[model samples]
Target: MRNYVGAIAAVCLAACGEPGGTDVSSAPGALELTREADGAASGAWGQGEARVRFASRRVESGVYRIEVRQNGMSLTGLVDAEQGVSSLDGFAEDNGQDTQMLDGDRELLAGLYAALGAELPAGSALAPELKYLRRAVGLWAEHPPAVELQRTVMGEQGRGYTMLCGYAKCNGKFTGSCGTTFNWYSYAKHDCQHGGFDLAANQQIAQLGDHATCDGDELYMSGGKWVCGEPDHQSRPKVQGNCFGRCGPGCGGDTQYTVDATNHDGCVRNGHALTSAYCNDQFTAASDDELYAPDCY
Candidate 1:
């Protein structure tokens, strides 16, 4: 999924600033998707500067024209429910003063068109048709969870450390893959001492270990030792007070917050693995590391 944090930043840079100059400190909050009695739908996030408006009017039997006004750009698409197709027909800017061919990812517009055509009744009023389109737009506009990163910095006089420091490194890595497998194992009674004997001849059984001597991909160093095991982690110092910041007036920066380091459970956001929830969850999925019986270890 495309990173919408960048989108919010773009909107803020364009409109969210101190009255005279461009200076912004806050990030946008969740999108506000709303519908009007006229069946027109609008979604605004990142304050009100970044906005999208959807309006549709039925043409004839299972066909409708969709107009999307997003920020300063206007996109038009046609939906034919009977044919099960949606296509971007035109694009314009500055209230249609400048027109150009539609380009780039028009899936959002097409999806909205198809959804509207399928849901809205024939000859239905504009308001009801756009209401459904609003929901689709809202889903597409849903923001990923805001992640907060904590960095350690020495306090003045080298006394203590502050938990929240600097920009908080908004962009961070998500969990990829994880599973603790042991390289340690034991063999049972195998009488393969003779060259004529098979390697597995008379091997009763095998044993596994609970502790991970080394991972499958770990390389062996001198003295037959693993390069490393699970690295040790230091516990975080207890934070005394809450840390909260607000966005500038009329900006959508309020919905943005830092994600704690421990919330990676593999759950998805915006149809993408933006967090480490999946891999982290796998670490605990199977608690029994020993493949064989406990006594076999």
Candidate 2:
């Protein structure tokens, strides 16, 4: 999905001294990327082909965690337009192998950045990274990378009720990687004290808004504070980033109430319920005089 924020700058990396690595920029050809109407992008840089896909979640009103999946690597690029600062948490291969690109994997980092930068939409949020990555490579002059992005209109946000969403471990194990869509939200109430789930991981948050509805089978609420629901796991979008950071300031220690997808009775309580209708009630009741009530169907 297109990121929620706009114009957050990119990170700077030192020159690459790593001798042996996949050198995408060093290949011979112009770098070109075309964003499809569906928002996914693909292109070729030198000898290899690269593709870009995105999943995003709002960190706050203006901050976003935009995961850029290029080829087989997932990059965590934090874009805080409100703050005007951006950072990449790091890169992880599809196999869950972490690569410390900042720690000396310069060649591969620059190559990945080049592909990612080139594949973004003409005015997309990652555009600034292209400039910074060029400077970081130091060899930009020798093999000056040219970025070509097709003029694709980014997607627009939907007009629906916004709700807080997150996922954590279940029964001492995470259902999926933080990046996996199927494992995005925990359908069970897995908390730090009761399940020994890491507090930092549980705090990584996302939102179900823009007219999206939760799965009817896994509906829940936290005493009218916020309602919990499940999105389609297979097709729900994915975001790249470590689940270590909390969603927003002061969201820590908030009690989470989730209906166990496997067994609903284990976590449902007085205020929480399993049906979508009850979820809507909790949502409507939580609003201020229903001023911003979600038009639940």
Candidate 3:
């Protein structure tokens, strides 16, 4: 029930992105709960980073660890914003606002620990609310559709490996007690409602849009927004033209060509931005905005 992918929604949340943009955060994964807590490791994420990684290793058989190294180093953080502002920002996900959330959690954690072979410390964060989670996990496990979240899927790694995927109703807000009611009717309906998860089997992964994978982009989600060190972007279907000038090896400086513009790709070389106006000339058919940060897709 964590909105880890919620970061990308802020810029175009109500505005509607590109009219036909690829639905980025809609994918469902088991590592969602884990990533949400890791990226936004405050408030509801009482589990902490250490535990999340340990539990994660149990799921994909250390495949996640391998992917991190394959990717870049800057992608360490996934989602995070500020005080009291969780990934489900502008909605709800703190323990303070809801108590029922804390109720059955004990059992929920138990089931998770049992499945992952992780041992819950005698004293752990959110331990008080666990008993609350336990009951809910049981009901969801016992019930048919509810039991679906208790679901597990074979990982992309193949070899018949599986990952645990789970879900519950969370409206980013609680009417009174945690389980008492939901703020958004959609979440209460239990049809994804922006809470379904899609665990990345790798160490870290994200996307800027349908155009580019966040692999080497150092992209992350924070306070319902995507955060990246550089504004580098690639077009969808992977633009297959000559990657020239700043987009390739110049940022407009003494050593590099880093031009500060929406259409300029934030390509960096020699520790400076790599950009040049010549790129705009190459893709004459494209709008200036579309060329922003045009790099080798």
Candidate 4:
């Protein structure tokens, strides 16, 4: 699955010495590999046509544990160069895309691939698309809904209604990933004064990883904020970068709320309030007068 915020970058460079430079041929060390298949166990070195070659130089003078096998059959065995001994382990099978060792053994898989001078199988059928969608759903669950809640509350003079909403940000574990966006709207009637509100907000929390990009009508609503323009990918924070760093200054925990009449022509004269808060956090309550509007005919 595409990781959200915690996806680590490729570490092959740091772990493996400059690619294509590490020589395994001249290593002076003993390797012992075993393979099991078809109700029989065998050594890994000097087996049938499918065998792994052992090569090591300037290493420990003791024996090393290794095993290789495929389809319940022995393919190659470990080698003791100093002792001049070789054995077989299991057989290899061609599974179309790449060679696969039936047993649940990676060492055997690597050995067989090395012997054949080919890459190992990709392993498993969890495609990239399914993995990412699952992650996006999980992120949405943690944060508060971006839509404003309109409720009726009892007051001294009579019953009053209020509208509330805010912005929320969800961090994806993987880097360079993108997510889907959504929009919402609502209307209501109370005490003879027909009331309605409309706003637009964009949600990119789902695609924070997988390096996905989106652009279309650009109409979206989230946390009471409206976004109509396209986001600049080049300047935006990447999923692989520091999550916390992008949380504030970069992503800017800001939510914009605006009140509009049922006509939807313009804001309710004075209905825009700007607030600052972290993504996924709740919005503070506003006075009834600040959000409530009387009948407008």
Candidate 5:
């Protein structure tokens, strides 16, 4: 499912360079996040196929331990009650985009594409769109939601993917990569935390260690503050970068926190009883708010 605040970013590499060897093993109900690669693929170092997977087990009510394993890399971390403070903390800068990992979480999902063994569109095909969109927003120069949490790249092909829509199609339109739908004001104002996004460009730049100038969106910041507008690829004939970012000084962490907490508390209270009633309807499943349910099993 698409992560809310701690969705994915700043993946914390364990000291032992492997998952179980890290703190995740100590969690009360430490469930393995990613499944072990099939033994058939074991000892096969040059497979060249990139697939990413992760999983988490609740340690207690409102608490979880998460881990991501892909290629030969692994990262482990925990999600505390308030969704702030994670061990995978880090700051990443690319192109003109600047993003943070975990406030406790901002882009744990980006680690997916970073390590994905999928068939990626050529960088050439990826550049023009990025170049165009960057120009559209006057090259806003701030990349929000550094990680693209749209699909889990399972293999080196298009069919080798799945959607992380924790709820249903969020906002009735934009698929939460932050915003790709032309007029995403509703989504930006309501559902950008789902950790999914729609990229107009057929090609995407794996911004982790392979990021080029062709990543991020122009609309991410306009005269300061998160906004949604102009040249939406899903609407207009241009590409738009509808990415979100982590908590920080000018990033509006305080306001976003207030908005998030209010919605989360509402869900923690009675969202299950009232479906589609609140804008945060998906929080129960997406954010694992169901853990707060009387019978959370």
Candidate 6:
């Protein structure tokens, strides 16, 4: 048995913004392998703005294989600061295992050639009577499962993170390899771990503790945590407003609003306002750190 593994990472953007975001879109269809000529093959796929190629080889009599091996992070625009690294590996093998043996007859080779979309030769070890064998088996072998690592920013602040990594084996038995595996992980600003946080809020304020005020009001009493703003209040301060001033509209976190008493308010003490308003830094930073890894088989 031969051991094989490969990785392919891609981030297809619509020529507008970052590699992984709402604006990004993926092209239809998966990568494919095909015979280019007698005893020759090719593998083709697209990633970002470029095309990628893998090497193919003829291993034995009537047996061919193709392989691409690499870490998912190496690909441009595939991985980013917030997104962790990933990998993929697999192989493609084609052998006439299902076809009946032709006892060293050249006619058997001719049939194989026809099955691969090649013109039959005038004279060969295989006879014209055995030409039907060519159509019996498909040209390319079954591809092994490609590995995938999908990293997503979770939670209201995007402070929470999760990575889903898995492998999907091919369905055909041309080779013995086939199956799937999945793993998950979570991380926060202080420490990278496993799990997530569920937040709660009311119409006026997002109360993580005792005390209430309008969203984006800069809760001096609440240790400076930013609120996501009330959905019902038209005047509610923007959530993740920190990035708005710096990154502009092209970056994540950009929106406008009308200030109203129901949504706007500044903390006050002794007839004077206290703490100045500031957006949550964590959410804005995380939004800028969109990253992704591809699935390859």
Off by over 4 Å in 5: 1-48, 82-84, 90-297
lDDT against the true structure, per candidate, is: 0.26, 0.29, 0.19, 0.21, 0.25, 0.22
**TM-score: model 3 vs. ground truth:** 0.14
Off by over 4 Å in 2: 1-28, 35-44, 47-72, 85-87, 102-105, 111-297
Q: What TM-score does each of the candidates earn?
A: 0.26, 0.24, 0.14, 0.14, 0.25, 0.16
Angstrom error at residue 31, model 3 = 14
> Model 6, residue 72: displacement in angstroms?
7.4
Candidate 4 lDDT (Cα, 0 to 1) = 0.21
What CA root-mean-square deviation does each model show from the true structure?
23.0, 19.6, 25.1, 25.5, 18.2, 24.7
Q: Pick the candidate with the highest lDDT.
A: 2
lDDT for model 2 = 0.29
Per-residue lDDT of candidate 3, residues 98-151 (tens digit)? 112122333233343333212222123332122212212222211211111111
Worst 10 residues of 6 by lDDT: 183-192
Candidate 4 per-residue C-alpha lDDT over 257-295 given as tens digits, one digit per residue, 9 for 90 to 100: 222111110111012111212221221121221122221
lDDT of 5 by residue, 213-263 (tens): 223423323344434433222221211231221111111101111122222
* Positional deviation of residue 65's Cα in model 4 after best superposition, in angstroms: 59
For model 3, state the Cα shift of residue 117 in Å.
8.3
Candidate 1, poorest ten consecutive residues by summed lDDT: 288-297
Candidate achieving higher TM-score, 2 or 3? 2
How far out, in Å, is residue 223 in model 5? 24
Question: RMSD of model 2, in Å?
Answer: 19.6
Better of 1 and 2 by lDDT: 2
